[model samples]
Target: MSTTTGLWLFRRLWKPAEGTPVKAVVVFLHGYGEYIDRYDAAASVFARSGIVFWGFDFEGHGRSDGERGFVTEAGFDAFTDDAEQALRLAARQFPGLPIFVMGHSLGGLVAVRLGARLAKAAEAVDAEAGAPLFGRIKGFLLSAPAIEVDPAVAQPHLVFIARVLGSCMPRIRLGGIPAGDLSNNATVNDHYSRDSMNNTRPFAARFASGVLAATEAVPGIAADFTWPLLGMQDEGDKTTVPGACERFVHTCGSPDAAFKLLRGRKHELFMADGYEDLITGTIMPWIEERCETAEPEAGGAAAAEAGLARDGMSGDRDDEAEPTDVDAVKTTTSEEPVLGAAV
Candidate 1:
């Protein structure tokens, strides 16, 4: 998509299988330094299960335009702009389908902000614009959300310095994500390492700062969240702290919010070993529960117009799907492995 700023964003979409009725529209947001392609298997599973999955590479990640691993100096808004653009795109492509936003790691944090944005839009601002979009968002799915960073890595002094440096040198490289540490599965790690489109370089200063800001602010804003949310994180997830997610779910005012700890798993919940169990055991059922909701009022009339104006985003609709369950889901596990198949 080419945004109003004339930036190109790479996007990917998976439609429901032929002869399958569309049940829902899901917009997935990936974590830092990763792209949409990483979730191909999972997206395919959603499609097979009657979901219309849509996602895009953030401006700096994957095949999208921008500096590698860098959200420019725009900080967090850059990421949210892309996500909101994606929501508008999905709404238009699959009009009237209940919208569900899912995010992993930093993407999880973005989803939180996006969810609050939706609620605020529908209730506080233009109901014509926000309600048409917000009210349609029935639920949210989070995986190892980066709403908080592990205190071990984000020490007070380190965080303070990063925030300071970020203000002055937003593009300076701070750290690099070691792909091998992402998953227990070697193939998954190998694939990630092989993907040149990914941001293998050191993290950008401002991007790091933006993430830290979200960690502190998002949890505090949990009081404003008003949607069904199911969050999962592994105890071994060194990538994101479990306690942070736990605190957010508890602090969140939503009556339907719940947090689950996928014990014995690694950081990459979807790509880790035994991901199938995680899907069938937890993630899918949550998806099934809230996937149904009152349809969007505009039937995506506004979203369709938004889609036509897309400078960012990528691509779903349906009801009474034959139950998009994991047991019956046929996925490309041979290529990599499992939650890579579901969440």
Candidate 2:
């Protein structure tokens, strides 16, 4: 409904139903080279659920007015600070609705760290309150959280350089890998390209540093986060290490965390084929469950059915260790199939 800009900020808003009980606020963090506008459909899904949806284009992404695809170590700290400011603004606008955060791709990493930081901050603000803004977070929905690295894919030397020389060279190109390198589902790429229109590939210093910081901080964040959490992982994602996303859910501070596998989905599960059901059925129900007054048990049977790791893999699978679906993509030479194009 409104746009706002400030020091290192880009935000957009959508109002909830008039006089409707503001169930909760959903703040979406878009991933690398992504803009908030891409979430229009997702936001509508939340609106139908009686939640207000707000999000921003991260620095260097979309129309944020920064060097495209660049981020440095210090820049990440600044980015989080800016994100907090946006949250504060949300508080002012929505008065008392519960708040939740969701992230996709690289954004998931940001949400994890933010949840931790918010938890600590909330602790300090109202130590006696049952659920301060921190614990009050209804839940976090992280789609294809980018954690760990796939051994099969060739590592990008430039990405490595940015991590090392982030301070010196904060601005660089971080895109332009191949389809197989990024995702096993070509349809995902097709949708991404069609929806985004501009396929600029640039990397920034802060992006690398932000990633480094997120990697080290996410586990601690997960360990400390007591709020409910839902993590959805695509079995065929190539950009993000797969098992790592699911592992994040199981290891979170909350024993009641839920993890779901979007059958045959890829990195951007929401963008994959048959994703409508994902948003309307699985995801919406998870969020709705959180809005309820009672904190029900999470994913009792779903987690087990989704194939939880019972061994010492610790979320990392062997390079050659491909499950049937993953291996199908890895071994087959045919053009990668898109899951949700017809939808």
Best by TM-score: 1
Question: Residue-wise lDDT of candidate 1 within 58-124, one digit each (tens)?
Answer: 8878777788866765677778877998898888767677888999988999999988877666677
lDDT of 1: 0.70
The lowest-lDDT stretch of 10 consecutive residues in candidate 2 is 298-307
Estimate the TM-score of every prediction: 0.81, 0.73
Candidate 2 lDDT tens digits, 92-155: 6655566778888777777777777776666676655635355456777788876554544325
lDDT for 61 in candidate 1 is 81
**Which lDDT values do the candidates have, in the order given?**
0.70, 0.59
lDDT of 1 at 85: 85
